[model samples]
Target: MYQLKESRKLSNTEMKECLQISKSEFLEQINLECSGCISALKDFITLNRKDQFISIDQDIKLNDDLINSQRIFKTFAKLQSFGESIKSIISSIFKKTAPQNNKKRCQLHSLKQNPEINIQEHVHYICNEIVNQNEDCIIQDKEFDYHLQNYLKTKKFCPSCKENIQAALKHFKLQVPQPDCACSIICFIKYDHLKCEIHIPYDPILLNALLNKAQIQPFYQHASTKEDAQEELLICIGLLIKDRLSSLYRETQTQEIIKYIFYQQIGEIFKRRLENYSKMKGEHKSQLEELEQYLKKEVEQKDKQKKKRQLKKQKRKEQQLSFDGSVRANYLQESSRRSISPSNSEKNLLKSFGWQGSPSVSPQTRKELEFLQKEHLQEINNRRKQLREQTKQCWCEWCHHHKQK
Candidate 1:
């Protein structure tokens, strides 16, 4: 009773003394553990005193057989333990590394096949994790951990599964270091874009359309593994929506337009945004931050180009004004030169006719010629004045409406 209960061994004589019982009585009263112990003890120490210390060949052979039996049992036990350990090690390796027959799809696929699922909760959690990452800059801070704890209790969830996925989400949930993983971060950015940037809320039709489009995009269709491609897609989709809004339907409250845009732009936008993110930040970080940096770089580049264009435009305008001023200066100079009166010899009609004396025509004829000359000069001056007025109307810097009529 003491050996079995206390999980310890005592010599047969000690056991007998403690029980105050004989060997025969102990044997008769033995339980399961005590019987096994007694049997093992008897096998190891056979009390064959028939040849005690006599050094007989039979006695030595029996002792050798007993030692061999014990040695065989010990070796067999070690081998059994080694085999079990190898089996456990193999099972663990397959469990951790295998992809469940290669059927496991990413979060997008989960959302896609089961469109009826309320992703609003997932979206809410993503946003909360991002908004409060604590002082550690680690996304899975105490607050986030507490929220997850609260969430698991309040909300029931089965493991994320598909035709490809066989394991429970809890398995990966424990393994992932951050609650704000790429997929979740992307979802948070989408929520922020919808709520903060677009300033619209509760558009069931539009939200459904966007989510469905996300599943179809290549970025979403790709298998979720080591790579964080969902973040790329999220940035692209958000950008696409914003670009669509700014370009086409900014203020219109139309769900149809959003749906149309969703289908039209998702693929192209996904690719473009992925390329941009790779160019801007490489694979350094996997959060909304990668998208943010890409967008900031794009904006800075655009601003730089815009300033360059403005400067070029300003330079071209200045050059054109300078050329116009020089042309006008030469024209005015010619006009002033033309305004001088005719010389004395050019005013005499008699000189032109080769008559030296002033006796070829009557005063009335001269008066008529002078009147004709004055009228011709007046008409020429009037035409020049009209041309100047038309040029001013067409080319005047202050006249914005000159091209209208």
Candidate 2:
């Protein structure tokens, strides 16, 4: 609990640095509590184990049921030969002497011609039932008879035949268990191309015991997510293989697990993650490219708008500095004509009319000059106002864009 709390406070990178661990190790430590991640890991490990074992034990490929059924058939054939040989030898001994012990031996070998179980009745259903049930599939007397007749066209099996069936069932149970076996084992054997019997590495009882252990029992928990399932898969494989190593292989020198299962089986548990990973990677790349293009184009458009705004500012400044030289010349000429000439007025006006010559321009010329100046000022004010508005608008747009980014 203390470790879990400490792990929570530290960032993943910080934790890794403190522990001096690789990225994979750091992530694995974090997901130890996550259920779905554990489940998925278990699946991969199961496939891997199957692959590793099958390469070495290719001789046994078929399911327990079919193999058991064949054994019954073979045993029945052997019993027939044994009965004949014993009878022939006993007949010669009887001819030599009236032997009570010989008669008893012949009596013991003789049977009432009634057989209880029929091997031919449900031959096909055996493998399917056993494999589907996993390592712990059990075929009790009642269940065996039911499947036998259910699959086969025949009616019922005799007592003599029943004995052979029971023996075969016992043998099958030793190889495969009655309950709690992982589905992966049955799948491995059922689909093998060779379809023959392979050496089972563990005893049925031992395998069951290993499976029931608390640490591994959780591997059978239902997975809500693919990652969760994967985590469980990896853990289950690791634990099982570790157990197998100490029990059967007896070698701790080797640290790596064999990955023959990856080559041999592409089961759903193993294949889903790979498919999802590839698909997600492709989607991520395409989306990233789209974002980059959009950002680049937006930057380019902002630059263009800035250049246009600067050009408008320069044009407004030039218009403000400009003056109408022709208008100014015309105004001066009008002013000169409107004024009284000094030469014409000074000779006679002082002696004859005693009128003083006015030096100021006329009221009409002064009013015209004031009106022209007002019009020029209004034009300049309008240009300045337009430039101010453009600059303000540009600044507001840029602020909004930055905020969004």
Candidate 3:
């Protein structure tokens, strides 16, 4: 909130903290000091941060000296009542030195020599009787020829003499003649037998009809791109309009009409193109939708076929499991009966070794055989479980792939 008001006054404590001084020092330096003195002290401290106070003070003194000097000069001028005489004096000095700096002589030396004569009358007489009459300075009079030679000298003249010469030569300069009639245009036909050239007048209306017929002829169909064709057609039409206007109307109002017509034609072309684009877009959209529907139907059919295959595989697995179980039961029963009754070869070998009656199966041996059979059955069950798990993972992976597709 304190920061919100940039011009907020600081408290005495805040001021002391900012100044890094005790209360007594702050009071001595700030409270008792005049506002100007305080501001001056603050400026001195600010300038002294980079040890620049001495240089700044010297600069201030120099500026003060400059201002005082200007004041003294102004006062002195006022006391002297110079008014605007200083400018006149400076101009007079330049004028006095000008002739000495410039060494160029006058072209019309005769005119410069006879300064007391009527220069205007002399110039008028030379223009009318000599220049206009002969169209050149081919004078029969020796005195006039001498003056003309002086006028034609290869030397620059002073400003006054140059002015007189320019006045005299003004008659020879090409001047745009003012039209006697209001409309300032002059039309004429010229035939040059040397060039075998003849002028033929063309009918603007007939040319316009021919141009219109040519414009209507189909050419856009042969162009590479529609936009290029349109641009070319527009250029041709614009050129045609320009040519027609050149001989028909040459005004800004008609130019505006041509522009409006051009823009209208462009708008119509763009509108037709936009409508065609929209129609094409619609057709493409419909085609894409049909493709999507067809793809969906294919996916459904594939899923059904996969489900049928999985069901068949599962049925075959179940049947194989049941058959294996029955076969295992029969095998276990046969092994038990064989264990209870010794084989004939084993009985003969026992008899030869003086074994009496049927060899009694040991209880330990029976227990061991049963334990082995149980282990084999557990192994078979584990293998079947692993096969079932592998089938389940394969099915899951197929489903994931199908979903992605």
Candidate 4:
């Protein structure tokens, strides 16, 4: 019976046949005895009885057990189908959401035509100009040219300059009279050198204002041969101004040009003040050396005083030790005198009494006392022995007389 129950629980068909019962009867018995056993059998049959077909009963006590088994199989099949559906959905969403390319989008165009002015570019340009003019100077020509080209390519013009250049380039003939030369050499020259000769591309009034701020004259002046000294001085002044202007111009930004120009104008106004600061002589540097020596002397004096104090303390400690040693020696001498004086006197008194200067009895006196004690003990023992012998002889005599009677 146990074997049949186990077999039914295991869903073994041969064991099921051995039970000799219908499937409904077996399931009913399993349900009555153990619902878990019936469920386990249903699961095992669902897993292993793929080839065998069995009619499931709707009214069976284990109805949900069997239905759940079929439902699990159907759920797996639907999940497999859903995997494919999910892939399709993802593909469709990717297709619909993918970015598109549009080729006809509008872009902003710059209205001004001229290239930008860059401060670094201006520095590179000035550096090139200086190098070209002064070939003897130790300057790397190729490197400078490379830097200048890079500067030109990367340079951007200020908005004002761009507008002015675009207008000038657009209406070149109408604005300025044609020059004798292409003006390329003057145009490419350093700004300081071309200050009075070049015409800035702006309105005449604005150009005048720019020149005033730039501290440049309207036109280059020709020197008279008769005024050679004055011409030489003016040339010197112009050179100085040109150098200052070039340095400031290369470092100044377009937005800061006006401010830089104003700064330069102020610098010129205080030229004497600046020069005074530069030329003002300082006190002799040897004064610092003297002060250092004085400090050294003060430090040495302090060190010497410290050493003197240390020496004085050491000397006081030595003197105190010497005094203490003398006092201890005196105390020891006094104690020795007191202890030895009494002991020596006692020894002399003992020697006078015919006794050794020691606290022990003489050997002769000790032997005499011991001999007297031994003699007294011997007398006592002899008396006791004699009395005992007499008493015993009398008792023997008395006993012999009574026997005769």
Per-residue accuracy of model 3 over 1-405 as CA lDDT, tens digit each: 222121123333332222132223322433211233333334443342212111122121112221232242332234234324433422322223232222232111212321222222223333343333323211123433344335324233354444444443232122233435323111111222344332211323322332443345443223334333333333333233334333232222223232332223222332233334445556777999999999999999999999999999999999999999998897767656664765575455456557686455545545654565567679899999999999999999999999999
Best candidate per TM-score, number? Answer: 2
| lDDT for each residue of candidate 4 in 31-86, tens digit (9 for 90 to 100) | 11223323434443333122111223332111233323224233224323433543
For each candidate, give its TM-score against the true structure. Answer: 0.17, 0.25, 0.24, 0.17
Q: Which pairs of residues clash in candidate 4, taking residues 3 or more apart in a chain or in different chains? A: 116-156, 116-157, 117-156, 117-157
> What do the candidate models score in CA lDDT, each in turn?
0.37, 0.39, 0.39, 0.37
The alpha-carbon deviation from the true structure for residue 229 of candidate 1, after best TM-score superposition, in angstroms, is 81
For candidate 2, give the lDDT of residue 32: 30
Cα TM-score of candidate 3: 0.24
> Considering lDDT, which of the candidate structures 3 and 4 is the better prediction for this target?
3
Which residue pairs come into collision in candidate 1?
Answer: 103-164, 104-164
lDDT of 2 by residue, 351-405 (tens): 3445444545455744654565567679899999999999999999999999999
Model 3 residue runs over 4 Å out of place are 1-257, 329-340, 344-405
Q: What's the residue-level lDDT of 206 in candidate 1?
A: 40
